[model samples]
Target: MKKYIIAGLLAWLPLAITVWVLRWVINLLESVFDVLVQGAAAILPLSTHDVLHQLVEIPGVGVAILLSLLLLTGIFVTNFVGQWSLRQWDALVSRIPIVKSIYTSVKQVSDTLFSSSGQAFREAVLVPYPHAGSLTIAFVTGRPSGTVAEHLDGEYVSLYVPTTPNPTSGFFLMMRRADVIPLAMSVDEALKYIISMGVVAPTAEGLASAPQTTRPAGL
Candidate 1:
């Protein structure tokens, strides 16, 4: 009975979580749409108030508008004028005291994670963690640089050791390149493994492709 119950839960859990997330997002978008409609009704002529109110009655309008805005913004930013304007905008924001500090930090991290040329979180690796007896999965973010690199004796890479079930919060460590073992699993597969708390594992093909390393004495 317990085994059957567990099996049933495994079948429905993912669907339930997915539905919950979608519902949350739809609710948020609808709320934003309501606000926009209300704001427009307040500023526009009384004649246009009915039209704005009617828009609020339509479902998914907010999501559609949000997507359209994002698409238009992407198109705009690709142009030379838009690029220059973006730089100017960044410069303006960067001059503000506390806001600049927060904005700059987030921007740097976003660029590093999302940029086409950036190496952050590109490869999954296995490394000794907590102790030499234990190994954990980590993502190779990049190499250490600047003053931090000056004190290091050899080539070292920065890694992110994501905790099980919550990849967002993790420990950052710098380890020698020679010590970390590269894995054959893709980032997506690695993430699934981590988020499932090792219940989901890489396929046999992926494990077969991983480079074989000689185990130290008892390990």
Candidate 2:
């Protein structure tokens, strides 16, 4: 009986949450169309309002517009001038006081993970975390540097331990390269596995040829 209940829940939970969130977003966007219709009805001449009336009556067009806007925004930010402006904005934020500490740290981590040159999450690794004898999933976030590297005794690399169901947030740690086990999974596959809470593990082999040797201190 317990096994059946667990199995049924596993099948239904993801579908239920996905449908609910998508419907909520659609409804929110649809409200914008409703406002446009009400405004047109009050002010526009009947002849001009006819097209607005007809168009706003459609169910999902507002959602389509919202998605299109987001797509265009993404494209715009990827260009040279937009990228430069974004960097300048970040530089301004880094000059603030309390905000600077939080924002700069977050920006560094995000850039290291999401930037084109970021190697963080490029490889899946295994490391003991939280406690000894307990292995946890980690991603190689590159080597430590400056004072941090000097303070540590051995070759150290940064690793991120992503939490289950939310891979965007996690704990960062510096560990000896020799202690990490490189996993046989691509970054995308590892992400899916983490977000799905291990339910969607992929069988594709990417790290099959990786040697079992530990990583050096720097990287």
- Scored by lDDT, the top model is 1
- Which RMSD values do the candidates have, in order? 2.8, 6.2
Which residue pairs does candidate 2 place in steric collision? 155-217, 156-217
Which tens-of-lDDT digit does each residue in 1-219 have in candidate 2? 999999999899989999999999789988876786788689888887777777787778877876787798778889998889888998898888999999988888778767987786788877777876576678887899988888899778898899989887999899887878777888888788788887887786744525745642333
Residue 71 CA displacement from its true place in model 2, Å: 3.3
- Whole-model lDDT per candidate: 0.87, 0.80
TM-score of model number 2: 0.62
Off by over 4 Å in 1: 1-5, 31-50, 208-219
Deviation of model 1 at 34, angstroms: 4.9
Question: Candidate 1: what lDDT?
Answer: 0.87
**Backbone clash tally (model 2):** 2
Residue pairs with backbone atoms closer than 3 Å in model 1 (clashes): none
